[model samples]
Target: MLNRRQLITSLALSATVLALPAPGLAQPAPTTRIVVPFAAGGPIDVTARILAEAVKGTLGTVIVENRPGAGGNIGVGAVAKAAPDGLTLGIATTASHGINPWLFSKLPYDPAKDFAAVTQMLRVPNVLVMNADAAQRLNINSLADLITYAKANPAKLNYGSGGTGSAGHLAGEMFKNQAGIFALHIPYNGGNPAQLGLLSGQVDFNFDNLATAAPNIRSGKLKALAVTTTQRAAAMPDVPAISDTLPGFEIDTWWGLVVPAGTPVETVRKLNAAFTEALRSPEVKARFATLMAEPAPSTPEQFDAFMARERTKYERVVKLSGAKVD
Candidate 1:
């Protein structure tokens, strides 16, 4: 039905259309990946997964890659060494960002220099708890009484922790230093066994993670004396903070998001905005509560300052405790 000139023009138009990509065949959106420097099924990994889902609209398809090993050095170090693009990010834990630099003689990454902080994700408060029977037997109803008893009865009390360099062990050391008392430290294989040891009366007290110890505390098996955070944890407002008695005494496990150092300020701001917003969302808060973690979002500057203070504090505590990576 077409004349020769019309047919030639139609053929040229069809050829041009064929040269361009169709809508469906256009390039797929790029994905952003966050590396969780811990094993899967853990709270850090869960947090990363939650953020990944929450930021899908802003960040496209976000992927969570778990690269856990060597006290989280393997994965976190990778992040430190990664390209400074916002595409690759990592979760920095208390051990990874706060303690590892001092614990290890040589570290793969410098906590202070290697990563740009996005924001503090959450803090899991470690609590000071005693066995119900032990507290009752010793008439230790309060932190003040515990400190007094520990002072009067030198080396008469003891505690258990997950391990020598764990948050619990360091908290115990801080307690001894600040309160001017002595309490024997028994380091179990892990937190569970340590909690079990406390439950079975193998150890008199422990600076235990609130999440694992909460049920026991509620069940009257363990008596919570104080939380290690400066402020009382939202999960347990009734319990007082140890800072109330021993000024400036604080210790806990925490984690946050970080990108490799040298990442552009704009990229860092984007990541901070996405994650901090996610942390503020109601659904995210609910999920964090399920893990007994309180969202402690902060600006990048605040996170950096906090990490510096933590590192300085832990340097003294770790040295005083005489704990080193094995």
Candidate 2:
């Protein structure tokens, strides 16, 4: 019933329709999981959540999971062992990547070999603080005063840290080495307990992360002497940097992203672009301001070099402090 030309045209059209892709058959977007090596509600965990939320539209269905234990080694080790598919990533901190290698007797994963750096996310400065009453009693109003008093009193002054090899501990030790002063070191189970020690006058002073100590400092329970960074913290502009008093003194607890070492370069680039965009967002910047942390996004190569430098610096601090987890 049909002419030959019409029949041929209909068959060709049918072939073209069948060759087109079906919408229902398209592959689903992969889910991304970001592991935080600290407990929920901590600074690193909070930062991870913020980043996950910011990147959701770009990266699709990103989630944050907390796996806290063994000074962040457990979660980081899990990430190190994850498939190098770029689906499982981690939020790495100064303690996890920089100090742990030197402090632990045996790390489950090698920092350099097991993971690829994505980008440095943020940097939080530690503050040197004393109990309000203690500072008033000792008439120490500044870092210089504390240093002079410690040099004069020697073992009379004591400092508290979260524990051995914590960023706070290493900061205290580094201060001691640079200042030529001696203050007895007291290691508590965690940062909160160490802060409690300082608040109750059990410890003379402490180096605490500004994120955790900002509330107390604002409430007048703690007196901030200086921030442990090269420059003054935006959150506490009135407080000077420790470097202002002790030339060339700086220690900051920074965090970044990393994936298993064998991940494809294209996948790493995609992640870096997403996170860097999030870091530059005004919303993320405002939230970080509330935490007294600064957004410090870096390229993958830059982050790798930064971590290497940090490792070298902390190795010296650990050796001088004689800190070991074994």
Candidate 3:
């Protein structure tokens, strides 16, 4: 359990970590692995890699292993079932850490009780886009146009989601629920494949992160429709926000670090310090700037609170979306 004092304390909590007897805790050559729940090249993996490299000097030899599957539940479940040792950590993302709890009827791991929060890393807004040619044909230059089209041709229009219970999927579902529209959903193996489906004309639209869609949008392969964030992102200032079309429609993905539940209190403190320090580094900040995501460092307590709020928010969205694991 997190104490208010511990949550509000801004001091480097890592210094207080007890040096548990790991294989190389004393040696300078210890290795640590950070498991990313999503596939490589996504925001979660990208941020984990960047932070891992930045903290390698302080946290020993850092490595990232991708175990993407089941809308990120498989990788996250791995962390949940892993030993509560300091060596095995996980990159917690919105789909895995936040939304899945509400979406899945029987999750292998409890999002609130089965993991230890380390530090909050970054928050990214999702981009809504369509293939350029499709955009031109539909004349759907804005979010308003898309909504109108969906309303006019409910069953004919559809959107792509990373998977049945993924963040992008839920964001689209939430949009449909809020706007009173019905768009067919086409789930893919991952965001990359979902984006590909949209690009190849297999799907009409996709809601994904700016980092994933930026290149396509810039190259005129995909046209930017709107961002799921309430405010316009610095990376795409000219694009309108989903909130602009439907008020109170904000659904951004947040990422963080966590360990298996029951990790020694001291180890959690040490890991938090390494992550917080990593977030403050110039290199990590530069990477976040490029991704159009902001690094948000928080105490273990604050991370816990953030996850709680996310759990509540996504529960409503999930129930509305009628999501379930297969």
Candidate 4:
């Protein structure tokens, strides 16, 4: 009954109306699982649990699952291959996201390509600690003293770390190369065992996480030589920076979140906003403080850039140390 032009207009309008979402459109409830690529009580694990608690209200129910193996590769690879529906996410670190690819001959997932950058969570210094008795025996109270002792003893001095390609190992190797010392490297399955090795005097020293090493350092069971940060850590104000002795020596482990690549931009933004807000919460702040980690926040883009820089830095360190995963 209508003219040709009117008929076409009516048909077009009907199609557009059909395409539009219904009024009061309901979005599916958010159910998120945060994957930590390390064992419980480790740096990445601690941070992930803190974030999980903080973001629970925002994400409906935030859960943390540990899938530790291959120096955090197993858990990270799981997230990389997960659905990009804002449900499964990963709490990534230098080992899982930056250092693993270059150190391993082949990685299960592409660090840069397989995941979406969420936000930089926190940064913690690497502490150089020695057994209480060993510290006294070697007369090593500071970085200078350690260097002097190492130079005199050469290969007699040894250190332990989490694993071959871990940040702690690379940091110790850098210290050895820069200071021109010949300290033996003793690699262990994890930081706890490495710390035990140091405590038992099986190893002369260890470059360990501030979170993991703080209690031992505080208890006077171990002597703090220095921290691997550009500036002295607020938690260990008396301890000097390693850079003080070895110029340009700065290696700090960092943690952040990443989602599967190709996730919707809106979802990424939502996650970034929620997580960043949670990072600023008072409870999380206190938790990080107790763990000797400096609470850090960054935009998604900033986190991406940080990861890139970390990858380059660790790549060079791995080459210098001749480090590879066993």
Model 3: residues with Cα > 4 Å off, grouped in runs: 1-29, 38-42
Give the TM-score of each candidate. 0.91, 0.91, 0.82, 0.87
User: How far off is model 4, as Cα RMSD?
Assistant: 7.3
Q: Please tell me which predicted candidate would have the highest lDDT against the true structure.
A: 2
Off by over 4 Å in 2: 1-25
Span of 10 residues, lowest total lDDT, candidate 4: 38-47
Please give the CA lDDT of all the candidate structures.
0.91, 0.93, 0.86, 0.88
Question: Which residue segments of model 1 deviate by more than 4 Å?
Answer: 1-20, 23-26
Error of 3 at 270 (Å): 3.1
Put down candidate 2 lDDT per residue, 1-326, tens digits, no spaces. 88999999999999999988887897668999999988899778889999999999998999999999999999999999999999999987898889999999999889989999999999998999999999999999999999899888888999999888888889999999899999899999988999999999999899999989999999999999999999999888999999998999989989999999999999999999999999999999999888888999999999999999999999999999899988
lDDT per residue, candidate 3, 93-114, as tens digits? 7777678777777777888898
RMSD, candidate 3, Å? 12.1
